[model samples]
Target: MPDPIPATATPTLLYRCMTKGVKDAPESFEYGASWVTARRGMLSVHQDRLECGDWTIPYSAISQAVLFKTSQMLIPCYILKVRTATDSYQFGLSGNKFWSTDLPFPVTREKGRLRYSAFSIIARVILIAALIWYFYQAWA
Candidate 1:
């Protein structure tokens, strides 16, 4: 009888090969560029300001796609060291799934984070007040 492949070995093989899977881009995701191509995994970026007025944002994270689902997904990975140049930004990210809708992609993890801008808050308040005044006048 043929020997059964060990569960431990399964992951090793998966890491070495790509799988055909379904992909999606949620409407809430907006960063870099996202698309469902023939590949699986995510690419993360970081930027360094050079003295020449150029930006160096490299793809510094690559992890194996541990799970790919329509809902919550998870990837066990780490970011690579930044690669910088005066005229460009170069880095590499390799994981099992490069793009996913499950969980947060590498950079989009900040979507739910606390970002308080006084200007933004003030703008919202003014807009709301103007809207209320318009409606009140229209009704009166």
Candidate 2:
């Protein structure tokens, strides 16, 4: 056999991210079967595998990868979901990294735009009304 690749070699693509959650993985995979806390780490995409800390998933095992946005604290947050045959991993990624083209699997966008909650709409209306009232008070 030939020599193995050195660990110090740089990956094809790398991003600093937080591992949000995992689906279908064993309870011991991370915090548990699912978690609300995010674990900070560096996600690297190699030619044949994806690595994040101790987790190494082969490219062939990835069924799909989806890029989506959701509202968090009234701000849009980008997420990347990587699905394998038996498990799915979710990562919180920056918007610029979401458009990267180095991955073996294609990343598809969510079907629709980020939907605002009723509470969000109500909050916007209240803010606008407050602004109008303040302007009227100043003019008067």
TM-score per prediction, in order, is: 0.28, 0.52
Instruction: State which candidate has the highest TM-score.
Output: 2
Give the residue spans of candidate 2 off by over 4 A.
1-35, 74-76, 97-102, 111-140
Q: Considering every candidate listed, which one attains the maximal lDDT?
A: 2
Off by over 4 Å in 1: 1-56, 59-111
Please, what are the lDDT tens digits per residue for candidate 2 over residues 15-101?
333444444433212222133444566666566777777778787888877766654556565666778877877765554433454
Give the least accurate 10-residue stretch of model 1, judged by summed lDDT: 44-53
Clashes of 1: 11
Predictions: Cα RMSD each: 14.5, 10.0
